[model samples]
Structures are given as structure tokens and as C-alpha cells.
Target: MMPQQDQPANPAPLGLMAFGMTTVLLSLINLNIVDATLEKSFVLTMALFFGGIVQLIAGGIAFKRGDTFAATAFSAYGSFWESLAFYWVLNSEPIGLAPAASARATASFMIMWGIFTFLMWILTFKHSWNLVWIFGTLWMTFFLLAAHALRGTEILLRAAGYFGLVCGILAIWASFCILFFEHTGVELPGASRPL
Candidate 1:
């Protein structure tokens, strides 16, 4: 019989924290609680480094651990962040693409992501209430942003920002729970089981 390899450390917490922190920052700007002046580079920087690269690393770890869901979530979202950062750069200032994309085009991009998030949320039912909530709010945030993009509605943007903030907080809580469990060997109340 072949011997089993040692179990890898869980990377979910790291991935979640990356997602959470990035989401929170962007959401704050959307909510207008923070200056949008930093939106041009700072948020994109976080998206590329922490949300994109870090999550990709976590996804790789999850893949090594044979966690299909985590691998998919991390890798896909990581790519989303990287692509989004590039998109903003391409749409802005010096490098702005010729015949720039229409608002409908941007709305389409957000809608596609919303659909993806919705699919992921469906799978979260088999995971935990925490995941369900996180994915649920996330999909809503995407859709709201898409609506705002399409209609140029400030209210929709604010709503998206609020939902995104909730999603970020939930992700952070899940990360903390997992980290706490890893350290204490006691599962916390939030992400212990499927609900």
C-alpha cells in the first residue's frame, strides 16, 4: 500500500483575508467614506498584489490539497482582480484605448462576473452558512455595480458598496474563524459546517 502524504496547511484563511481586505478598501471608496483619489492606483495595486497574486498562491495550495472549490474560487477571483486592475489602467489617462468601451460594455463585464458569482454561491450551499452569505452578498454586489454601470445611478453604486462591505466583513470573519481553529483546534461558530 502507498503511504499517504502529510496533510497540507489550510490556505482558505489566507485567501479569504486577501479577498476581504481588497473588497473592503474598494467598497469604502464606493461608499464615499474614503477618498476616491486613491482609486486610480492604490486599489488596483491591492487587487494585483494581495487579491490577485496572493489568492493565486492560496489557490495553488488548495489545488495541492485537492480542494477543487477553494482552488477554483481563489484562482478565478485572483484572475478577476488582475484583469480588473489592467482594465482600469487601460481605460484611464495616457494608455486609454482608442474608441473606448461603452458603458454597456462595462456593464456586460460586471454582469458576467455576477453570473459567475451566482454559480459559486449555488455551490456554497454545500459548504457553510458563512460561505453562502459571503457568496450571496458578493453576487449581489456585482449585479448592483453592473446596474450602476448601465444606468449611471449613484444609488446603485452605493448599494453595491454596502453589499460589498458586508461581503468583505463576512470573509474576514471566516478567515479569522479558520485561523483561530487552526491555532486552537476548536472550530468557531461561523464556518464549522454546511448549513
Candidate 2:
């Protein structure tokens, strides 16, 4: 038999860290803890670079590693970030697409994303508790934020922001787990083995 090709280094940690840090920053704004002044571009920059572009690149690497789940998750969420940034730009004064989408439209977007997250969360059961919790809490965050937008309720948004913050923390922890495992060959408590 021919020799197997050498495998590339793990890229999931980079993907997870990108998504996690971006989620935390946005959650802070959603929780109204950040200044509105940075709302215009700071978020957009992260969305396009770290969240969108880098995540997508990591997803492609996962695909090369034959990890369909990682490929899907990274790519989908990367697209989500890109689409979100595009939406913001489309409605901004510079572009003026269609007079900005309504809160209901945004709610619909979140609901769709919630459904997607729940579906993916179901697939995480065999992976690890960390994986399950990450996607599971993310599912709730999306639905809760959607509910708030649809109903024009502030409380749900706050609740969703807190939930998203938790998801981010979990993601960051998982990322560190992968990176540490690669370095020291020790698995972190709740995280799964690297893909």
C-alpha cells in the first residue's frame, strides 16, 4: 500500500477562538455594556476578518481533515457573520439598500438561525459535553434574541445576551483545550479530542 500523506496541523482551535471572541464582543454590545460610538465599524471589522474570513479558512482546513461537522459549523457561522456584516453595510448611509430591514426581518433571521443551531446541537451528543453545551446554549441564545426582536421586548434581549456570553466562554475554554492538548498531549476536562 502507498504511504499515507502527512496530515496538517489542527485548525479547530483557531476557528473556535475566532467565533468565541467575536461572540463575546458582540454580546457585550447587545448587553449595552459597550459604547455606541464603536458600534459602526468595530463590529463590522471583526465580522469580516476574524469571524467571517478566518473562520471560513479554518472550515476549509477542517474539510481537508475530513471533518464534515467542523467544516459545516465553521463555514455556516462564518457565512452568518459575513451576511450580518453585509446586512449592516447594505442599510448603512453609504449603501442605502432598501431603507434598512425591520426588526421583524431580523427576528426571522434569528429564528432561522435558531433552528439551524438546534439541529446541529442534536448532532453534538456523541462528541462531548462541551460540544453539546456550546451549540445547545447557542440555540437558546438565538431563539431568545429572536423572541425579543419579534415582541419588541428588552428583557429577552438581555437574557439572550447573557446566554450568548456563556456560549462564548464555553467556546473559548474549548479552544484553549484544543491548543493545550496539541502542545502537552493532555485533554482538558470537558472538551472532546481534536478532530
Candidate 3:
């Protein structure tokens, strides 16, 4: 009797993860560019609202695929940011005596997100150090800095911006890796390497 041959597993889930990461990176890049170049409230609002929506959707799909930590973290924070941006868009005015009230609100949100990221880091500790975790950690750091920046701190804002840039670059690189694998069946050398 001939030996049974093993079958290859579906690659769709991995592809989805890659796609989600890519979208996130692109959105981050867009936001960063707006911050660095235009510095307009409108641009920031649009980026946050639209990007948050994308992240929410991607996170939802990831959740369905059993990436519980990623799903919850992304979906929760994405929704929070988007909703906050929408609130500001509709209100168009700061609340009372908060010293850039909008900034304070943002800071609070970031602090919450940072806490979630820490949880995610703990959950994923057993996993290998890869682009996903690296970006995840960077995302958490951005939130931490954002929290500080919202307290009228310029240094924190600068630090957050630098970290955001790094996150964006990693996201873009991860996206290209997926695109490459999808099209040409080639793999990168690290965590995203082909099985």
C-alpha cells in the first residue's frame, strides 16, 4: 500500500492577517503624513474616522479566525478612536476647562489603549518575536506617548510621531511581504516565512 500524502493547509487566513496589517500600516502612514505636513484638524479627523473603520473591520475578520487577542485589541481601540473622532467632528468645540479638552480626551483614550496593548503583549509572549508583535509593541508605545502628549507635552508628541513612523514602516514592509508571497510564492526570512 502506498503511504498517505499530507495536504497543504489553506493559506487564506494568513493572507487575511497580512492584508489587515497592511491596511493598518497604510492608514498610519497617511495619518502621519497629515500630521507632519498639513497639521489640520480636518485631515486628522478624516484619517482617524476612516482608518478606525478599516481597523475595526480587519480586526473583526481576524477575530472570526480565532486571533482573539488581536481581534479584541484592534476592534476595541479602533472603535474607540473612530467614535471619538466622530464625536469631535460633530461637536466642533472643546468641552469646559480641560486645557485643550480634545487633547485630554485623546490622552485618556490612548492610556486605555496602552493598557490593552500591554495585555496583548502578555498574551502573545509565548509567540515568536515577529513583525506582528513588534508592530503591536510599537502601537502600544504610541498610545503611551499619545497619552502623555495630550497632557500638553510636546516631547511626548514628538516621540509618539517617531514611533508612529516606525510602525508605519513595519506595516508597509509586512504588506509587501504578503503581496510578494501572494503573487510569487516567495517567503521572507523571519516569522512570516513560508511554512
The TM-scores of all predictions, comma-separated, are: 0.93, 0.92, 0.62
Q: Lowest summed lDDT over 10 consecutive residues: which window, candidate 2?
A: 1-10
Candidate 1 vs candidate 3: the TM-score winner is 1
| Candidate with maximal lDDT | 1
Task: Please give the CA lDDT of all the candidate structures.
Answer: 0.91, 0.87, 0.53
Compared with the true structure, model 3 gives a TM-score of 0.62
Tens digit per residue, CA lDDT, model 1, 87-158:
878878888884466889888998999999999999999998889999999999999999998899899999
How does candidate 3 score on lDDT? 0.53
TM-score of 1: 0.93
lDDT tens digits by residue: candidate 2, 154-181: 8888899899998988988989988887
Off by over 4 Å in 1: 1-5, 97-100
